[model samples]
Target chain A: MTDLRKSDRLIKLGLLMIAFSAISALFVITLFIFEQGGPIMFKYGLKSFIFGQDWYPSEKIFGLWPMIVGSLMVTLGALIIGVPLGLATAIFLAEFSSRRLARILKPVIELLAGIPSVVYGFLGLMFLIPFIRENLGGPGLSVLAASIILGIMILPTVISISLDSIRAVPDCYREGSIALGATRWQTVRMVVLPAARSGILAAIILGMGRAIGETMAVIMVAGNAAEIPSSILQPVRTLTSNIALEMGYAAGEHRQALFATGVILFVIIMVLNTIANLTASRQGKR
Target chain B: MKETAIEVRNLNHFYNRHQSLKNINLEVYRHEILAIIGPAKSGKSTFLTCLNRMSDLIPGARVEGQILIDGQDIYRPEVDVVALRRKFGMVFATPIPLPMSIYENVVYGVRLAGKNNRPELDRLVEDSLEKAGLWNEVKDRLRISALKLSGGQQQRLCLARILALKPEYILLDEPTSGLDPISTMKIEDSLRRLKQNYTIILVTNNTKQAARVADRTAFFLMGELVEVAETEIIFTRPTDKRTEAYLEGKFG
Candidate 1:
């Protein structure tokens, strides 16, 4: 018995050491990013660095306003395209579809998340961008193209999580409503949706994080022009695209500005992730 | 002779080729509390769900039966299922309160029918809760979450919810099984008062409960009803040996 207890303690210590690696790595990365990027914000004045318009790296002038706006616009557009589509598909799978049909469709939708982001970017560039250029009349690569690709990319995350949450609602609630003369649609609208509200909101929030944090696909489709876009059809540069495009030979303050952009991206993703967690926790309270 | 409110003829229910209810023929009278007593897997609950067509929601659930409510066959495709469902208010073995305020839980069915009048909704909520014997306890905290209520209170709230629907028949499938004795007595009191307005069918495992409250008693064994008679006759001089054995605690 003593030997078994000793082995258990050793195993616990071993697992604890392994778990600390990820946390420590995250701590180191956050520290390094702040150390490299934090000085530039203070040196250039935080206000101008965040709100300035000019992006001449050689001149040491870095205004991130356009990229911030670009990220927000693209993220908002992606939500507009993704939310209703993903939620509708989730509802259909969880409540309406037969088991065989849901089984086939669920795996296929989840498979969308596995395809490389680069492949999605290439598809958008090859088809969606060209279509927009010819018909909608703008540079093929624009915020609209990026938003559409990102929306499709995040569907699996949104759909699967939303589906799980909807299914999590107790069958008894559905029974109660249906027994009260509620149509299937009415039961879904009034009872199931309300019961699953927090979880659905969390799923959407996580999807939002995915849309905003997406770097490679946005770089490929959003024609990287570092200027505040007048309209969605116009080319715009996101914070992520700004860093990836200019980081190759960027020396001195240019590299620091890129790191600063990463810090902002990290902060935004952290906030969204925290909000998603809080919403999911609320779901457990019931 | 009592008027029959519901008639079941040649009733057979199946779940994926496994018959759950077999050749059920029963008549439920107007304004009477009919208790169905049986052991587990005896089709008591299935019979209640079948009456309201709630069994139809289950996949691979097939029914070869004629259930007539008010002399009209409820199985016809054109017979609006929503309206048919509203005609039989059902309470399950476990109380299920929709995740909402107590007042909202009561009026959920009413709201679905597009009745949004605030004062009328308030009145309906009060009347339903009063009828369910839950008004005094919950009247002060109508806006609180129904989930916060005790199990017994929640069950009564479920009863109030169905009361608000103004259903013709009250179908209870072991409603007080999860509740305490006091709650069970209170629910029985509500039922006695409610029988003046609505027909009720109760499925229970407790034989004494049936003896105490049911005007008529039925014994179902292995998907088939062995006998149904007046509560006194069924308990004291049961014609079926199975019913006698079940009532005597010899075999369940």
Candidate 2:
């Protein structure tokens, strides 16, 4: 009995230690970001710093609207390009393609996802940016470049998630529809897509979060312009790029302003993540 | 001779390298309920799916058979499989309604066949629901999700969905296996009424159910047909000793 009690206590201690490490990791990360950027933000007033658009270190006029708008525009552009393509690929992979074709295609999609974002940025800078500059008459490093690169970067996430959701729908639903004399495409359009709608929506939201929070790839391609871009061809600066670019050199009010931008970007991502979580939970219940 | 609703000639099927159905031959008359009775893995479901070409959905499944519906060879390359399936529908042992409203589920078949007018759709939905013996229970909640219905109601909704297509032959593979006694009785009653307008081919493990609703019964064992006779004869005075042994509950 004493030996059993000692073993039980050891198991409990191990579990507690695991749980503490997980929570401590999360807490430490959050606290470090706050500790580094918090005091300056409080001193400079978050609202003025965030809403203000001008960022001139010499003149001391700093606002983050251009950065926020740039992030929103680039994310929107990525979504516009990625979501439909991802959904189409997912539908083909899950519903239309033969098992042999699906087998061949699935790993290719996974490989696309596995490639590092920096490599994608490099490829975009080397081939896509120059091609667009020659063909579309745009700056080599433009919002369009960032958007297209990020869109390709997030495609695998959307396709894989949407495919899993579509596949999760029981074969019975497909058989039921087919047995009713509905064509395969008709069944997919009318029954399968509707059943997987929430999951597909969650995929899109996750893709959006990935696009919004991406820093390294966007910084390499986006022109780092402080002004809000009026066209995809023009240079722009996103919230993430702004933080990464200025965190090293910024001090006092300028550093606080960049942190304020981070806070705003963090809020947008939180909302998106919340929506994805809620949708997945609701789909689970169904 | 009376018109045959379905004809199977020298039917054989394979699942990958394994043979599933062997040299099956059968005929189903119009407006009659034909029951296929067998123990598990007897290829009864395979035979039923062959009628509507559903067995082809599985990978590595191949069929060497000729299935004729109303004198038309269904396996001919010129024949439209989708249209053929619409004319000959099926229901599984477990009820599976599309994830849609009750009204939508009922008219799904009709809509797929391109009948889109609102008034016509509403009429079909009402008529099909009534025919499936579910209109009274679900009339007030036609817009409610079909998943919200009980298992029995979902089964009936699936029935209504198939009925709305106006198929000449309806195939049911153990349609009441998952229902309670009352629900099973309700389904049996519904099938009896439905036989007036549609021919039904049902596969069941229950001897009593075969005796209850079948006009004729076909007994199968180990992927081979053992006996086919009128329901009364098969239950009370089976010609084959295997059939007799099976009816007597001696090793199905």
Name the runs in model 1 displaced over 4 angstroms.
Answer: A275-286
Tens digits of per-residue lDDT, candidate 1, B1-252, equal 999999999999999989999999999999999999999999999998888889889999998979998899888788888888888899988999999899999999999988999999999999999999999999899999999999999999999999999999999999899999999999999999999999999999999899989999999999998999999999999998889999989877
Which clashing pairs does model 2 show? Answer: A52-A63, A53-A63
Query: Candidate 2, residues B115-214: lDDT per residue as tens digits?
Result: 8999988998999989989999999989988999999999989998998998888899999999999989989999999999999999999989999999
Global lDDT of model 2: 0.88
Flag clash pairs in model 1. Answer: none
Deviation in angstroms for A50 in model 1?
Answer: 0.7
Write down the worst ten-residue block by lDDT for model 2 chain A: A35-44
The i-RMS of every model, in angstroms, reads: 1.5, 1.6
TM-score of chain B of each: 0.99, 0.97
